[model samples]
Target: MTASPERQMELTLPMVPDIEIAAARAAGNLAREIGMASASIDEMAHAMIEACINAREHSGSQDRRIYVKITGTSLGEGNSRIDIWITDHGRGFNVTEARSRRQQLGAVHKRGWGLQIIEAHMDEVSITTSDDGTTIHMVKYGKNDD
Candidate 1:
């Protein structure tokens, strides 16, 4: 089978209420075009929303903007995958330390579950953070992927 060219979309959003919905909608549309299952598309949208909200609230970026990139790559035989990267230029925090603190806080807490939600929804998740900023990378496989 021949490989198809990757499809990509990028969005920059000012840190504002209800803006995350636009990002989620764009992600859902791309996932659908890539032949991702409806359920997976919904999950991806949810993850996207959470990621954006997390960045907006916690990133502390002076620019007050969120950057999102979505890439869809064909895996041949009707299979495909979508990768999403969410970035914020702000003071960063240690992921490990944050996770530990969240664990201590427990599920009883109503907030700070964005990371957990994103991880639960996406097939693969990774994070990079430094004093400069934080970027979250997430991927979800298409319906036909084994």
Candidate 2:
């Protein structure tokens, strides 16, 4: 299949939760610009923020570094979709433990729901990591971007 036209934006953010709002705002604005509905934009923002928050909480480093990329295409006629990738350069995590924690969404914990929230809001979700770092990938499709 032929590839669709895509645009991408990248950001290198300090591994801090306070700065994630800008990422969400950027994602939301791009989603809207590409015809994503307001609701879908909100969902996209949520997913991006969740990923960033996860990086903030889990990534291990003296001066943590997070890399984020937002990519998407306008599918023509007011339809569009966007993919977001949040990457961190820190000590990786245990895939099994992380997966298990995500599964226990209602465990009465104050947090640990970021992964679940990301999965719920995005159309697709993928996670990959190694001793070097972790990357969380997610996508959202526009219903009526206008």
Candidate 3:
């Protein structure tokens, strides 16, 4: 079986209230087009929102902008997967330290759950950060192979 070419969509959003919704909607639409399961689509959308919000709130980007890219790749045999990347050009922080702080805060804090939420919803998640910027990469499979 031959795999189909990847389809990609990109969006650049300014740091603003309610702008994350647009990114989430775009992700959901792409997931749907790629035949991702309904539940997976919802999860992807939620993860997208959390990622976008984190970029906006934590990035401290001088440009005040976030770049999002969603790519759908066919795995052949009716299987597909969606990969998303969210990037911000700002002074990066230590993810490990942040996670440790969040764990320490636990239920007392009402915020700082974006990374956790994204991890819970996406099939796989990885983050790359440096003084230059941070980029979050998330992936979700279209079907439950198990």
Clashing pairs in 3: none
Task: Please list the residue runs of candidate 2 whose C-alpha ends up more than 4 Å from where it truly belongs after superposition.
Answer: 1-3, 102-108
lDDT on C-alpha atoms for all candidate structures: 0.86, 0.80, 0.86
Q: Which sections of candidate 1 miss by over 4 Å?
A: 1-5, 101-108, 144-146
Tell me model 3's lDDT, rounded to 2 decimals. 0.86
Q: Candidate 3: where is the Cα deviation over 4 Å?
A: 1-5, 101-108, 144-146
| Residue pairs with clashing backbones, model 1 | none
True lDDT of residue 140, candidate 3: 88
Could you tell me how far off, in angstroms, the CA of residue 68 lies in candidate 2 after the best superposition? 0.8
Better of 2 and 3 by lDDT: 3
| Cand. 1 TM to true fold | 0.88
| Candidate 1 residue-wise lDDT, 1-146, digit = tens | 65653789999999999899999999888877777778788888899999999899999999999999999877877777889999999998778765654544446656877888898899999999999999999998767423
In the range 102-129, model 3's lDDT, one tens digit per residue, is 5454467678888888888988999999
